[model samples]
Target: MAQSEHLTIPVGTVGSVDSVGAVDSVAARMRALDAALPARDGVAVFNRVYLAVTEEVGRRLDAGGFADPCAAAALDVRFAERYLAAVAAAAGEGRPPACWRPLFQLRRHPGIRPLQFALAGINAHIGHDLALAVVDTCRTLGCPPAELEDEFDRVGDLLVSLEERIREELMPGPDVLQIADPLTHLLGSWSLERARDATWTAARALWALRSCDDVAEEFTDRLDAAVGFAGRMLLIPLPD
Candidate 1:
């Protein structure tokens, strides 16, 4: 029952594209990511989960799911641009935002579980990038965060739904998740629901600080550092 305009390829399949900057370029980015990163790589694990979410959103958009498809697309593209920017920076100058430094640094460390990589990336993206992306979307669409509330909520809901799947798909297995395992303790400490709520609050706060350039920059910096700290903790190397 998919719409006629929807892409025929399954979600998470990367394909050739000119660039990752366009709203239609998510699948392309995903495709590049899949081709570039090894299957067991930490970043790839998160990228696959993220790619699925992005493709699903695209399908919903094609089906006219959002009240404002334009707003939804803007939000989606801006959000993705932040993540891609981090990747590019990490690959080149080795200076991504504080929130993203951990994942990039530990991406290939065998000691870090796939679940940890996935959640740490989620923390960086949601805790830091999401607020900025909201502002970016608002600026691009020439509106305020209040105007994009519905789109924001819808996208957040999608993320929330995927969080469960990520855990289930990446989990080390029931025997490995015993209470004695540090992974269990690590997994229990972070909650996507809490992170989503915090991001919404931060977005609203940033929107309010739009006129105060210095204060807003400082606020953003602190948020980045704090999220990065959490990511560092999440990426703690566990024993094999």
Candidate 2:
């Protein structure tokens, strides 16, 4: 595990008017994280992928691509904080969420491919963090999940596109990949589209269960474990 490195930006409420600054602050922190880690570190690999996505999202926000800039910024920042918090926790004595533990634990292993690290991080973030981020955004914006649907869908679209690009850029080319390769099968098994769909459902369910604290907590814990299990599968070491 890496030593604790404090992230300077404080996570706080972002009102509608401060959306741009909030997004910029989040992007800045991710840039700092990217600079701090060794390039081959699994966490660093994932961070680079995420940093690209964050930069693109920031560009979209500046270009007015989202219908609700305030809602989009809130969702984007809250979504990012979950991943950052996990990194921070793992850096210190505290443990990250179950969903994120596998990647952090195996980040430096020789056998795991960069693509595996990238997807595993995506699995942890999308499968687990996204739902909670939705709830967090709702609480901050004082609106129901339904109201945030457009922003959610838009952000998800960006991730789905990025997933495709990640596979292309990191995975062995089609000419090089063999049918018997475990990486091929593993890649075939998980789909970001499926994960995003499931996340939306989970977010809605969580919102519905918000009034029931114990039940919601149990649901979240179960979700965390399930996603972590999937992440572990995604990070399975493959032969060179």
Candidate 3:
């Protein structure tokens, strides 16, 4: 995708706010992006999926689902900012993280299925961004990863459920999807449950290495590149 193709959304608009207001702002920004992108655009597909998740997270916050509402809100907003920043970067000369590059680059490829685009985006966000978001949340909230464990798990559980729905709604049906299908193999190689577990570990590791700036930066860079590689694999175009 060209730089001009990525319509700029002012990422800073979703600034720090109280618990309820923070989530509301994130949902609002996502909804705005949903309205701006082409319906069939790959990024739009993922944006719609994320917006649904964000709205659901907001609903849960309203219903008092999280044990630590404030921590939850902080984590949620920080998590969302990483994605919004990537979008903003793609819109300008700034480069998005390696983890997010594939989706931005392949957003308009016709041969890639919507499922592929969705999972690729999920892979990058969950596999790389979520871990850093956890660290970011910890710093902002002045707590350890363990303190934020409940919120992380709750948000992750929501994502896992959403992944199921995405597959159900987007995957080729049994009659059409054959044993030899490349999509099956591609999708099978990645698992959200595993990614979530790994992200938790990475978050903890990042927290531990925080004092070692150089080491932490190297680790983060490696994580970004690895997730980007996985995203590229997930986005491999298959026969329609």
Candidate 4:
């Protein structure tokens, strides 16, 4: 049960209040993820890498003492949006949008880079607000997912930076010309491939967890191997 003191809802805001029911849903979702993911038993670690990291983003939004996930998530979104706008304005050719785009082609990846820096601030706030159980579970990470609420905000920031860089430098973003071999990217000047790999591995694990139905010994064995690799991915510094 959540502590009553922690349940205090501040007044005067549009979405200040929270209910016990909403909180239960978040906990249930996490349990479902924990059970579903461990089922693969680890053999197919990389199989789900592409999809998992993006979804696991939630673990950061509802960190400590959040009785209402909606409230927690809403707060996170607002902070991220505001943070992105401010930084993008400073970085962009002085233009900041209500929402900044992330991917060069897709919808989620950030187009700008500096926005990522401001986002780090917002992430800390979310981490501080997480529930006790959630905090304990992810305690191993010096700065866990719960601390990264500004992730989306950073994405927006990057978009603005990209735009500004294009206008000012008349240059292409990040690595303008594509390399013949991706391995070159992984091992190139300050290769960010390592971070990309980590995100991919973690995302894969999440995808596998989200998809499983069978709960057997073989499944458990595979899940173990998958997590072992995923854990190692997290340890490597982002290759920038």
Candidate 5:
């Protein structure tokens, strides 16, 4: 087993506004937009969508609770960390190595640099850490960790070359996904659909990671927050 550290679980809450609309409503719409997604594709896209969701919701809650309650803020932080850890672990463990195609495709977008520098740093590091985790897991499982290890090395190399690659853009542009789909539409710099899908899947996968009897209760126990970073969410006013 890998050397372990104690994990702290922060307390967070979903205010009435967050539980109903900010979270439920947005999540529903985002799912609608992603109706056509393949399950496998969902996994690949999870981290991107998740970071976006946490950043977006976190912003809303932060604004609403800027001076409200510490418990709520703690809850949001815990939720964010749990989701990220799950996403990172997923990217770390798998049969064949997962493709980075989606990630690379996103990189070509016009806003990549700024998005990376700002709200999406978690994605980059989680991505980097997860890629390495996959290698480590593969080694433990007695699988050939060569390809994954190489992939990890490639990303590690790129991470040193730039800032955005060092972190991820919180979800793709709203144009990148439409969680609301045909039922409704989503448009903005960030896609609400991608964010929702990512959060759901990451949480689900993270929750499912334990293989032993104690796995369910013990999983994510090793999770921790990324250090020294700032994240944001925006509420834009569109001009008619």
Candidate 6:
């Protein structure tokens, strides 16, 4: 594994606004991360992938792809804020969510390929953060998860589409994906579809438990740990 290091901006260095209704803020954060990280670093690879997805979401929103653009913007911003907060927290010597810890911790291992880093980050963010983001959006909009389902689906679709391209762009080769390869098996074991299904379920469960703070806390903690475990597995160093 790579030496442990933090890649997030320092707390208070950037504005702590909860969400970004405008694309400028999210774009700025992406640029900051891009500038701060080396291209070969695992976190940088994942950040590039995620930045593209976010930019596409912004373009679609501007083109009126969403029925409720406001809700979509809120959900998008809230979802991204969770990630940015985790990075900032890590940078400030504070604990980040378990799901994010592995990416930061294993960022520079030579044996771990870029695709692994990107997919592992996606696993953690979508599995844990996206569910919580849904809840956060509902709270911000004074509505329930049902009200934001459309936006959630739309965003989820974008992520799914990106996953396909990520695989295509980063996969070693068609022959390399054969079952004999460890990377192939590792990549095959995880599916974005399954993760998205589980995220939606978790979001609904969180919404149901919003009234019971204690239960919700326990549930969220478990989700974080579970997603983190998956991320750790995905980051296993592979032979060159």
Highest TM-score model number: 3
C-alpha RMSD in Å of predicted model 2 compared with the true structure: 1.8
Better of 1 and 6 by TM-score: 6
User: Residue 230 lDDT in model 5?
Assistant: 13
* Predicted candidate 4 versus true structure: per-residue lDDT over 188-236, tens digit per residue: 3221223323433443333344345453334434533443333332222
TM-score of each: 0.89, 0.94, 0.95, 0.19, 0.24, 0.91
> Can you write out model 6's per-residue Cα lDDT over 212-238, one digit (the tens) per residue?
999999999999999999999999999
Encode model 3's per-residue lDDT on 1-240: one tens digit a residue: 543466776664324835577888888988888878888888889988888888898899999999888989888888888898898888787999998999999999989999998998899899999999999888887889999999999999999999999999999999999889999888889999999999999999999999999999999999999999999998888887
Q: Can you tell me which runs of candidate 2 are displaced by over 4 Å?
A: 1-17
lDDT digits (tens) for residues 31-113 of candidate 5: 43234333223332443454454445445454573333233333334334334343334334422112222232232233333
* Tens-digit lDDT string for candidate 1 (101-189): 89887887989988999999999999999999899878766798999999988999999999988888888888767879999889999
Model 6 TM-score? Answer: 0.91
Query: lDDT at 78 for candidate 3?
Result: 85
**By TM-score, how accurate is candidate 4?**
0.19
Pairs clashing within candidate 1: 14-31
Question: What's model 4's overall lDDT?
Answer: 0.30
Q: How much RMSD separates candidate 6 from the native structure?
A: 3.0
lDDT of 1: 0.81
lDDT leaderboard ranking: 2, 3, 6, 1, 5, 4
Ranking by TM-score: 3, 2, 6, 1, 5, 4
**For model 1, where is the 10-residue window of minimal lDDT?**
1-10
Model 5 alpha-carbon drift over 4 Å, by segment: 1-147, 164-240
Roughly what TM-score does model 5 have, to 2 decimal places?
0.24
